[model samples]
Structure formats: structure tokens, C-alpha cells
Target: MTSSSPLHILVIEDNPDLAANVCDFLEAKGHAVDVAGDGLTGLHLAVTQNYDAIVLDIVLPGMDGLTLCRKFREEAMRTTPVLMLTARDALDDRVAGLECGADDYVLKPFALRELEARLKALVRRASSAVTPSVLRVGDLEYDPALIRVRRGTRTITLPPIPLKLLETLMRAAPRVVRREELERAVWGDAPPDSDALRAHLHVVRAAIDGAGEPPLIHTLRGVGYRMMAPDAL
Candidate 1:
């Protein structure tokens, strides 16, 4: 079955020929594709960017698919579906792939049409699953889909930068988000000068924790930031 809308996909394969074929096929089917030749680069892109699904090769340079998938789930806390590609058809390999967080598996030398269908199915299932529509830290609530932020009964207006900062912080509430992680999430690979994050953070802090409100956002000097109810501190 063909996808109803375009999907943004990442292909993490070390083989030049296979990577090119998969990318070309997916693009021809109206999907946006990003390629990473090795596992390190793949993990970086997977964590920093939003993707509908990922096509990962089991064996990769720098790091293997299983390790990257585990880190993506455990360290990054992302729920993106992963469909692993491997030449091995052994039951142990399949089980290992699943145990490491792959949602589906495809043996290499497989049909291109089948690969596309599997990727589409994974995206469909993930999209249909229920997830928290809004993210919150104490009184601060962010509706990402609606592009709205509210603190208690007050509707907070924020510029794009501050809004992104707020959402990132809220998503990782009660857990300190590293400054570099914040920068990458907002600006991707081309982060501006170091002071840019500090300036935008000030904006977020002021807008989110106004007068008389127990400050929800906290900064750890030389470290990073986190958002949580004051009582939890």
C-alpha cells in the first residue's frame, strides 16, 4: 500500500550501493530521506532531528545498529519506530534486533517494495498510537501540535525561539537537559554563538515563571537546565 502523505525517513547503512538504492526508492515514492554512512552519524541525526521512521542496518561502522538503537531508546528517550536491515536470517539475530528496540526486521537482499511497505506500516502504527498531546511542568503546559503555551489560566505568548526552548525543557522535566542537547534540538548542527542559548533561556524563564509563581524552571550553573514543580526540588 502507498503512503497517503510524505514521510521523513533516515537510512543508516554503511554500504554505498544499498544506501543509495533505498534512498532513491523512498524518495521516488514521495518521502524525504536523510542518509548517514555510519552508526555514529546515524545516532546523531536520529537524536537531533525528527523522523517518521528509521531504516537501520544491523552492521554499521563506528557503532552497530543494536547499540545505537539502545542508546536512542534509553539515553535519548525517543520512541521512533526502527526497521532493521540485516543479511543474517538467524533466529538469534532477529531476537537480538528486537530486544535492542527494533520494531521490525527485514533480511537484506529483500524486495524494495516490501521494504517500503514495512516502513509505511511502522509509521502508520506509531502515528495511530496514543501519546500525551500536551507536555507540562507544573502549571506550565505546552500544546506542541497547537503551537500554544499556557501557564495556569494565563495564555503565554512567546517567540519561536523561546517557544522551542520551553517545549524542550518541558519534555525533559525533572531531568537536567544539557546545554548542547538544547542547542542541537533547537538549532541542529549550526548552533550559533554560545551566548545565544543563554539569552533565549532568559526569555523562557521570564515568560514561564512570572511574579508570585514558584519558579518551574531551574538552572544549574555550568551544567544545564530543568523544569519541575518547586515542591519536587
Candidate 2:
């Protein structure tokens, strides 16, 4: 995407020719683009640094784009818009990518200008959505509007996805939200294939139930998770 001030972007694609073409076009448009030949390097760069947007490829060594994108949301807590690249025109791959947290995608052999347009739309959507001011369950609090969480006096910093998950749980405090329902809220129509939810929940719980705090996020065995003060449970 072209901006008045240049935007920094990451492109994680293994194809040398394709990567070079994408980078060259974006650089010509005044955006700084960082290339990662594989998923591992891409994940590292994305986790450690901040980028305005990411252009990710679905297939790569070390890790796939689907997992990398999911980790970006679940672990890094990054809300940076992602534009996924794929060679397949199959609907399943696109859905899988979106479910894994990609903001958008373009099939391979596409126009550079079209990719750029989708990337611009992704950035705009990330910036424009309005979220509620506050959601609380007892001492636990999550502010989607500001993108912050708090329990008692402790402030919990979570990546965007976990934070959203926390908000969903807290808003339904003391009630066991069904697995299907929570998944829909977290990943929209497409959820992860593996048991990825629990991993993200672990990070959320670590931050939310640290030290003497009674765990408010409770797994309801076969059901789902519920948020409530221990006394309330």
C-alpha cells in the first residue's frame, strides 16, 4: 500500500522470482519490504519487529503460512493486517488462511496492483474498526477499544487474538460458552485444524491467573471455558 509516510512490510515467500517481483513493486511504491525466504525467518522477524502489514505465502519451509499467521495472532498478539499469497485457487486454502488469522489473500499469478489494493484494504480495516470501551468479570477487565487487559491491579498485555478471546469469555462470565460458539467468535467461519485454541488460552491464562489470582478462566471439561471469580463458580 502507498502512504504519505512509507509503510514497512514483511513478505514471507519461498519462490525467489515471485518474492523479488513483489518486493520490487512495493519498494517502487515507497513501502519498505523485508523478505523472508522461509517461514521460520519470517516468524522471527514478525514476532520481534513491528510492521504495518505482512504479505505471507501459504507454503514455505520450517512452517507453513497458516501456522505462522495463527502464531502471529495467538502468540505475538499482533493485529498487523496480513495479505496471504497462495498458488491454489481452491476455496479451502483461502478459508484456511482466513481462519488462521490472515486479513486477506491473493491467489498466485495475480497482478501486483491487485495485491497492493487488497493490502491497502487490509490496513484500512485494521485501523477503522471501533470496539467497545470495557468488559469486566469481577476484577478481570478487557478493553478492546484500547487493546488492554487487567486483573485486580495487574495489567495483562496480550496479543490481539487472545485479547479478543478473553473479551468473549468475560462477556459471558460464569457461563460455559460452547466450543463451537467461542471458535466462531475467535476465528470467524474458519477455525484452526489442530488444537491451536488451547495454546493461545495458555498464554491468556498465564497472564490472567498469575501469582495469587484465582484462575477465572476455567475449562469446563468437555464443554468450553467459563470466566468467573472462583467464589462465583
**Candidate 2: residue 232 Cα off by (Å):** 32
Q: Which stretches of candidate 1 lie over 4 Å from their true place?
A: 129-233
* Candidate 1: C-alpha lDDT: 0.80
Question: Whose lDDT is greatest here?
Answer: 1
Question: Per-residue CA lDDT of candidate 1, range 1-233, in tens?
Answer: 23588889999999999999999998998999999999999999999999999999989999999999889987997878798898986666765666566766777788898888777766765554223479977777888776678889988755445666787888888999999999887666656445556656766776778657899988888898988887888
TM-score of each: 0.55, 0.57
Give the Å shift of residue 192 in candidate 1.
46
How far residue 184's Cα lies from its native spot in candidate 2, in Å, is 23
For each candidate, the alpha-carbon lDDT, in order, equals 0.80, 0.78
lDDT of 1 at 110: 80
lDDT of 1 at 155: 86
Whole-model alpha-carbon lDDT for candidate 2: 0.78
- The TM-score of predicted model 1 comes to 0.55
Any runs in candidate 2 off by more than 4 Å, and if so which? 1-3, 129-233
